[model samples]
Target: MDDDHDDFVGCDTWDEMTAWLGESLPDIPAGVTIDFGPKDLHIGDEPLDDEFDDTDPIEALCAQIVVLKHGRYLVRRSHVVMEATNYLDHDASSATPNLWFDDDPTGDCTAGSIYVDDAGLAAEICVTWLRAESGLPDPTEFGFDISEATHLPGLPGTDAGWSLDDFLRRLGH
Candidate 1:
């Protein structure tokens, strides 16, 4: 409420974090599809809860979300902390693209998730995160632009705006 970073209460657990994000962000635009984290558990070095047996199937935190927009893919990843959302070029002819898992040296190998293709939705998601984190009700009031949002390795031209054409032109297609 104070607009201070220290005053903002970040999530302490994965469930809290993901659920907060899901509720805080706007619904994905029509034609957009999103995939959450894998059903399998990737607890890494963390100790398993006493309530479950070693054979029990634990659900992994919904940390990796992939949104496919305009045939391209944008990955929203969260490690110990949430990271900048990222994008990948459209490659396969299939409806769903294969998600690759990076083997963490520390051993947290959780696969990413997905959403349907739509650049505006992607940008909106980024802006929403920025607003939530910064405690800004109206992003523009603070002069926040999509460019200043959490889009990692960002889309090409700042002129194209948050559209399919922007991604296409940036990719040089």
Candidate 2:
């Protein structure tokens, strides 16, 4: 296995991608969560799958994922795109302190999902997405220093880590 990336073998279908990612990325920390959606079946503009029946045409995609990263929400669609969004609102950087988490890929208010490596990164995204989505701790406390591998405040894994609900309650969310 190469240190740069896990021994991940590419597969054609989203199901294969799902198997590989879930099996390969075992070290994802406790609180982090990564969701994998169904594969898209489309013939040009028409969707061939039932999952997309009610979903918007543009938002429907293959291998969609939503995760938290560094106190913000990051969404990955079609395995090649990672977009940092607030999720609750698709504001698209229309205002100051936009919902994005980083300034690199997300600098222009976006990111590429290919930048995501494995579970370690996934967990960070999980916490980030949760913190923002929960609307807790107040936006005034936005700068809470949660680095990679650092558990959420009060979570069992860290000295100051806390559970998601507890963190929210502490701030009266």
lDDT of 1 at 29: 24
**Taking the tens digit of each residue's C-alpha lDDT, what string does model 2 give over 1-173?**
11112111243333443344344344223323333222232233344465655333333222223333333323343322222233343222343322333444333223323234344454344334433343444222211111123434876854434333342243233
After the best TM-score superposition of candidate 2, give how far the Cα of residue 151 lies from its true spot, in angstroms.
35
Residue pairs clashing in model 1 are: 33-115, 33-116, 34-114, 34-115, 35-114, 66-113, 68-117, 69-117, 69-118
Candidate with best TM-score: 1
Every model: Cα RMSD to truth: 13.9, 17.5
**Model 2 stretches astray by more than 4 angstroms:** 1-24, 27-114, 137-173
RMSD of 2: 17.5
What 10-residue stretch in candidate 1 is worst by lDDT? 1-10
lDDT of 1 at 114: 38
